[model samples]
Target: MIKIFTTIFLLIIGSTGFAIADTDYQLHAELIAKNTYVFIGKKEDFSMVNGGNILNTAFIVTNEGVVLIDSGPSYQYALQAKAAINEITDKPVIKIFITHSHPDHFLGNQVFPDASIYALPTTIRELKTNAESFLDNVYRLADYWMAGTEVSINSILPLNSTSELIGEHSLRYLFLKGHTAADLAILDETTGVLFTGDLVFHNRAATTPHANIEAWLLSLDKLEQIRFNLLVPGHGEVTGNISPIKQTREYLTWLDVTIKRSVMDGLSMNEVINLPVPEQFQNLAVLKSEFMRSVIHRYPIYEKTLFEQIE
Candidate 1:
């Protein structure tokens, strides 16, 4: 009886059995390429509007099994994502690669406890320091959807940084230090899909609470040289062309320059925060709020630099 009722609830949420219940998090997925699928999240922060479904998580169906790029926000969302993957294929998820230590990317680690979860040692270390606190924040912000969730650390992540084989598929791992203290990007050579975790936000303004803008810009230059036909960003819709990366580059560059200019002018942080949105970036998703967040994150460093120059 409970199973039947849950199915009915899932159908009502338009999950078609992908979602476990009609909780606040209603996960919906779409196929971006052959054997490649991604969950489209709201281009906003974790809030009631989207119910914490604000990060893109993807999986590539392989001949041997399924390979999940990053888990979703909570244990419940991970369960929903797993169900969604099952809806498309019967293969059990054998390997999970974390792109970064962000809460949205790894909180669902418990759902795939049986699967091998992989990440850089740096990523694992960062998660070790911040995972519990980040999980607590998520639980408070998205309480209803996070009722049964808890942080699950991947003990195997520190084993190595070498590339792994998923059946016959070869996934190349690139360790990058931008967007966060430790960020890893993956390229599925079989499908030509590059999963750039938090490093690139398509149409949405990126959250830079943990970013090194200079390092991020350098990473962008390297990303431009990657040969891929499809890009599945950490947030926003998937794209066939690399325009999204170029667009992200523009926004990041603009923010970097704008912050420096504000500091050079000796402008107060409030002044920088209140600056009008750039005409080029006005149309992007979540501009105002995210721009302010970026200023708040980056202004301190610039202010400190100015103080040193004065002294």
Candidate 2:
């Protein structure tokens, strides 16, 4: 009996150690301007591993208080973000704008108690119905150690077809259905900066798992009509002018054409996976293998001719 108990104890200890070994956290903070800053949480590159660090969280701050763009994946991340923001400014976070309902974008919302939270109506519904599964998946599939912990999500500010003015900026909420039914972009007219959330990726591949490829392509074109001096993407670095937006449009166009052709030709998903990106898109940061997988996962719905698409 003593031997059996001793073995179980050793196994438990070993299991605990393994869990700790699998978790890693790193946060990056950059000041975009005198009054605005962007904080990002980085995890280990998991493209090589089956399920490793795969998501990043971004925060945007202003003088009145802080307007959190997307919460990180876990409570620890939320805490880290709060601490980082405190270092930048002493004001309480006034509002949190969830770009969508994705767990990575909103799970860390638990950290802020004094803020009014805003999200699309669809996002609020999705969170109510799917937050449980979302939390479970993060715990099971995420590479970070804090995935096993529970994250609290509270207060849903749902916007159907309206814009909110915060401070000197008017946050025009645009409903984009492609990436997720409730994906939103925060357009700041004061600085001509568009907080694109996940609508565009600066240097990395855009995640399209829950995206509508056709609508996403069209959304890109619509964004081009709007003028913005800077774009704060959900992932990768911030971009200037309209070049990155144009590049995203081009890539989506190529993806729609290439993948649709492969699908019609009876090519298996694996074959489509091996398709090479166009030479023009080779220079974009998100076209690499890791981001390519994210794109391929949502390849089926994105059907359109390259010529019909614009850059």
Candidate 3:
């Protein structure tokens, strides 16, 4: 009796640990329409781990198969994503669309080995050139939060055209080069869903590390011309109206104006970093303390001006 009780106790403890591990990487699937669904990942805060807060992954699926927009950071995430899709449909994932070369968006490419991977030429170049350092950084800062997984890099499909048809839907790929050289925006004409990647952040603050502030503003203008009822961002919740896109544009505009004024006044990057957001923007949900730091890090106006001076 003692032996049996001990064995049962061990099994219960093991099961409990497994359950906790599963919850650590929470995955949620929401049906957006009749045949389409979005998979959102809930993982530990990546920015705070190395860079701010927790992160998630979003993808669109259909009956024919899945056309993934972005892959999450870990192989485990990919596996979980695969499982989530399988739960809804048994068809194979036919194509994978990578919005950019960011690890949070493309590291899970290994999971869809048979699918044709699509990306911008510049995106492919950055992944090839900096993948090593990117992985190193993830391991260095977010290893504990990564769920012990690795992904292999392979070939990627290039897109120089404006649009491509995936399944029964037509996805228009627009080149908006600000956040990254090859940031692609997908517009589904049928569903009126625009997968804007990082081009437009609804409530969240937009990062501009590899961004061109002037070019970004122009891209925003172009996006305004296009019609999209649903805007799916790289981070944050989905938006139904054009207000988020407009808000993102306004934020960038404000940043540009503020930075330019500071530059004219000869204010230092450190000074700009210490500066706070205006009282007007403080009411916005995504413009919290966490995003303020990201904005400062990404598009440090003083840093750019200093670099220009050095050059």
Model 1 bad stretches (over 4 Å):
1-24, 154-156
Give one digit per residue, the lDDT tens place, for model 2 in 1-311.
44335435545666888422333345556776535667643323332231322454444556567777777666666777788788877888888888887777777777786788888888788788888787767655543444334545557677665576667666677787677776888777766777777777665556666777678877777777888877777666677777667766776667666777775676767777777766776666546664457546744443333334533
lDDT of 1 by residue, 35-144 (tens): 88888888888864455799899888889899888888887789889998899999999888888888888888888867988888888888888998998787667655
Q: Model-by-model lDDT, in order?
A: 0.82, 0.66, 0.69
Question: Predictions ranked by lDDT, top down?
Answer: 1, 3, 2
Best by TM-score: 1
lDDT of predicted model 3: 0.69
Q: Which ten residues in a row have the lowest lDDT in candidate 1?
A: 1-10
The numbered model that scores best in lDDT is 1
Q: Residues 46-132, candidate 3: write the lDDT tens digits.
A: 542322123445556665677777777766667778888888778888887788877788777788889888889889888888876
TM-score of each: 0.90, 0.79, 0.82
Error of 1 at 239 (Å): 0.8
lDDT score of residue 61 within candidate 2: 56
Candidate 3 deviation (Cα RMSD): 6.4
Off by over 4 Å in 3: 1-23, 41-56, 283-311
Residue 198 lDDT (model 2):
70
